[model samples]
Target chain A: MQMEATIAQSVSEKVKTSGAEAVIRSLLAEKVDLLFGYPGGAIMPVYDALFHYQQALKHVLTRHEQGAIHAAQGYARATGKVGVVMATSGPGATNLITGIADAMIDSTPLVCITGQVGSHLLGTDAFQETDIISISMPCTKWNFQVTKAEEIPAALAKAFYIAQSGRPGPVLIDITKDAQFGEVEFEYSPCQNVRSYKPEPPINPEAIEQAAELINSAKRPFVLFGQGVILGQAEEEFKSFIEKTGIPAASTLLGLSALPTDHPLNVGMLGMHGNYGPNKLTNECDVLIAIGMRFDDRVTGDLSRYAVQAKVIHLDIDPSEINKNVKVQVPVLGNCKETLKHLTQAVKRKSHQAWLEQFRAYDQIEHEQVIEPELKPLGPELTMGEVIRQVNELARGEAILVTDVGQHQMVACRYTHFKQTKSNITSGGLGTMGFCLPAALGAKLGTPDREVVAVIGDGGFQMTLQELGTIFQTKAAVKIIILNNSFLGMVRQWQQLFFDKRYSSTEMVNPDFVKIAEGYGIKGRSIKQRSQLKEAVAEMLDHKESYLLEVHVGKEDNVFPMVPTGASVSDVRLS
Target chain B: MCKDFTITVFTEDHIGLLNRITSVFTRRHLNIESLNTSESQIPGIHRFTIVLNTTEEIVQKIVLQLEKQVEVIKAVYHLDEETVFQEITLFKVSVEQAAQHNLVERLIRDKNARILSVEQDFMIIEKTGHKAENDDLLEFLRPFGLIDYVKSGRVSLIKPDEELKNLHELVNEAKQANNNQSFN
Candidate 1:
């Protein structure tokens, strides 16, 4: 009886299937439950296959191809799993370029499948044909073009593996239409090895010891971490490492929510609009340990004058990032989860009371100069910071805060509180506008239990507002707060600070955003008065469905603690 | 601070890898002086030899970026003084012009060039040397009505190491261990 069953299973597994069906089966094998995409001519066969598999694979039809990709990014960031995106050739594939680049720089894992023209017509300028594999080469971690149906199963298996392994980034697999329609014997085995790709470097005990010794003997050691901790799922390990040493830590923009916002040693955000304490004290620390974060120019400010007084220790999964930016004294290369555990075991428990107090002193100065006025402004006009403060009060650090670019993004990053890892999703690397609306919808889908709030500026809100249809269709229950300044706020701030305040095409004659949301059948409110702020935010949050709240904020309000271009972090402004 | 450097990359043989590798240079606005690719000593693996003139800092960054490519196993850059390198150039000259200039024959023989073919209309001579030597021969042949000339990119071997072999052995051992663990 057992032999008969085994033979039957083998026979069933060897059944012939179309390449499009194989692609669906491969996704099933990878345990992909949700997909974000748009349907078009080149991808019609795959969409046809998808119809029969709707019960198993849920597909969200985003309004635009760019919206689909960004939504996939949000899903990946929220769930810590590989996000999947599908789009047709040409413009459909090109629309994914921004989000692909964003995923690459931020290390979000995504597997993007783009349909191409028929194999015979690939280079012949067939309708909807574009060389996406070549176009995405610079951005994707790896990419392949599949011209034969027989290659579908293996190509998709490899795509999932490459996209999710070792310093994860987006991977593109372009399939010709003929290949999708052709028949093949479907078989799949998850790729275990690629021969050429080594995802994780072996941890060196000696390097761990060297880093520990440096940390132990240092007068003041500071930790600057990025999304690596969360990407590696090493948040607990990171917390233990910092808590044992009692060293105050700051985070790069994407690194927020990896460590609890209210943790004793959690200092603040780091970058151009970062807190005054971390920026000012960067030069004062004797030892700087950077984990899972590259020293971006925004974070480091002037490299020549940044952390020159410190002996740096960098722990990262990517070896190329070790000396690519600021030079490090000890380089620990491996998954930070394992590396942090090993380092935590090696380092001694100690406290830097005086060093921590120095941060508090600067924090006090910053609160007086920057934070207090913005969050609790005496001015009649609403401030972006106050809207964030209200949302933080209502959500209580539980909501997933997804933000778009510009002043609202900085303000939300500055004021939003997060208690759990992966709770803060934003366009960190690309600074992409119009990212919040669709990304919030995707985040809500990925983590259905969490409240996903999107804080967007007036200018950015208009970019992807078409996604209100997506919200209405899916009923994603995303809470969107638009800080309406009626200007391209960040550029205006820059012009005010450096460009002599000549707002060149920065002002906007806006539309009725609430009416637009209502047109899409989503509930919304437009508020300008401070008295209505609390109830308006509460109403948006309390609504059973997705809601939009547009608050009129100060038009010329600028984000402070700014590190002027080419200036040192110590010279961060507080106006 | 700009100086000539040779970068050798060991990678898995895969389609589109060359594009992936070159785009790193293209993105940085760095121009390649020459580039060559072929199978390496190890079975199934490919090697890339690229020559460029850039600041050491920029070259180091470029090599690091190249190593970041998925198919690329390893990438290392070497200063000109650290490696022995040469390029193979083929010159096709008009037979009539070559016979008119007796000095061309002497120059070819003096430079250790070999006559590969002699057709009625053209003669083909091959020379293997560094860029300077190849350029000198080209200038000499230009007066002899050089019909066509083509030179391959620099092919180099590091002076004091067989690092590629060592890396291959290490990779093999790692693969073996992974297989054993999976079986268990």
Candidate 2:
């Protein structure tokens, strides 16, 4: 448990500081303004140190550790900075697992610090002594444990560097109790490189030329992108690339906000429940240029039939992602901003008017069969789409929308409009429920000037409803909209469509959400009639503070344009 | 095809390094048949040898994944024919029976094993070979009042040298950097 004294030896004057103080000082040096965490016995020293540095940092005490991490994720997603989360050992550390996994799959940068028992008591089944490092190893970009005081600054620096660099993900550092209490001479330095680790791999120029040649020569070129654009902050570059080429582009679920929803070349989302044109035309496209997206199973249904006719050009930052799922004719590896800038310089301006019209034709058909009826509901019951449609109009498609996972998540992603980059945050790869409530808190905290809206379903909202206390304390000014369908609507849709109408346990008997919002001292309202929908949404947006609006929607409504399980992306259902 | 393969990983020695390495296997649900670890020829680095029965496709993916770990320097897998591998086994037999029979001496000589020590209660026999050969010796020594047995995980060496002169250079440069006051 001895720490290396080599790094701090050169300092002319070294202040003796405890491990806890070193951690605080390191965070300050990293310019971490806000941290979200919960306190416990093992982590008390750090919290005690946090008390001394209250003026320099802002710490949000979430109701649960999961809330803390998801809030951090929201903050990270909204802003490009790495988010920080802290918790104690055992249950406190374990509670952050879901959010950690969510951040890992979605490539959000987060640094999680968990307390451990004394160094000597790590493996003796001591109270609150769980092996957080081992538990988080698979999900983290890198993880380490510090049992000695002198190692605290070095490990924190490494953790921050690893978490924020390249294809960012979560990194955890578990510090034992002795390290927090022990004092050592401290000198802080940021880690710029690790011998075996290279954050950004070098891009191949020849492959970029190959990709540019493919884009220029093809008549029916299509672009599919994901969060890598936002992660790289290359939204402008992506927009210019597609606009200059005059090619049709579609986004994965997490890539929604990277391009303006109303952009002429930006054709909607690309997934199972995505827009009609994107899903149906994936196999028909000639040259498929995938940027920053891994072609996840949800986006590429029945991989054997997905984009088989197309010559694939894949651009990504991670090397392992390059032929991991779909084979690529040309692979360009590096940060998307740098590579896209290079590709843009090489690509010539061209238009595929005929190919673009085909997408419009498909969109027209989908509009006639699906979007029209949902937006203008003739039935007595309210629908989820109408709620999204109203919200879309009132917000002018500019509000940052944080969505929980389920049928409602699909509905929001489908109908919501984005006018700016980094405006959409949700659990895309992990499909984690209860993500929006706390994430919306983080998002609003990160971008206080921007309006933040959290769209949740009754089933998903109930999972993390305890975060209402956080909202009440922080007054994050997030607009919470709930689409209340009395069932776990997505699973129920599957049961109805595929399982012969056997509902099973998908149905949920719930309490009044508006009443619950009132208990948290937040403004609230619920609408069951169509006449109240527009005004209620407008009022929710007009309110200066946080507000919750619940709308009762059709119980049996299902998300359409779905490529059935094990089916090709082209075989989308309209009902 | 699904068969035995040994994956070797080189990494910097650090606390929880073993747990980090094993967690990769645990995540993929790949069962480790045998594993061995020790310091390599290079200073400040450690080597781990892990044996798993999986398909060639899976093993390739696993190596790419293991290389992604921050501390891991390199990860490569080799088939049985590609490398020379061995596992050591020890057998302890009753001392009284050992004195009465010539079969024990004959079996030990045939297997190329040798007696480590002879004590009052039991005698110990040691053998080093592949798993199959070691198992054969254990079976041969079982009938003569076998007291206890233990076997170590496999150790392996490929045919060609795994020389990375640059890696040694980096180590030396790190030492040089430590002595001076240069920061990047």
Candidate achieving the largest lDDT = 1
Best by DockQ: 1
TM-score of chain B of each: 0.89, 0.87
Label model 1 with its docking quality class.
Answer: acceptable
lDDT of 2 by residue, B1-184 (tens): 7999989888778777888788777888989999999998777778899999999878877887787787777788888988889999999989887777775668566888878988889988889999999999888777788999999999997654543455455554543433111221
In model 2, the runs with Cα more than 4 Å from the true position are A1-14, B93-109, B139-147, B162-184
- Could you tell me which 10 consecutive residues in candidate 1 chain B have the lowest summed lDDT? B175-184
Candidate 1 per-residue lDDT over residues A283-401, each given as its tens digit? 88999999999999989999999999999999999988988889899999999999999999999999999999999999999999899999889999999998999999988889999
- What tier of docking accuracy does candidate 2 attain? acceptable
Q: What are the Cα lDDT values of the candidates?
A: 0.90, 0.88
Clashes of each: 0, 0
- Residue B70 displacement in candidate 2 (angstroms): 1.5
lDDT per residue, candidate 1, B1-184, as tens digits? 8999999988878778899999999988989999999988766678899999999988888888888787787888999888899999999989888888774558556988989998999888998999999899999888778889999999998775676567667556544533211111
User: Which 10-residue window of candidate 2 chain A scores lowest in summed lDDT?
Assistant: A1-10
Q: Which segments of model 1 are wrong by more than 4 Å?
A: A1-12, B170-184
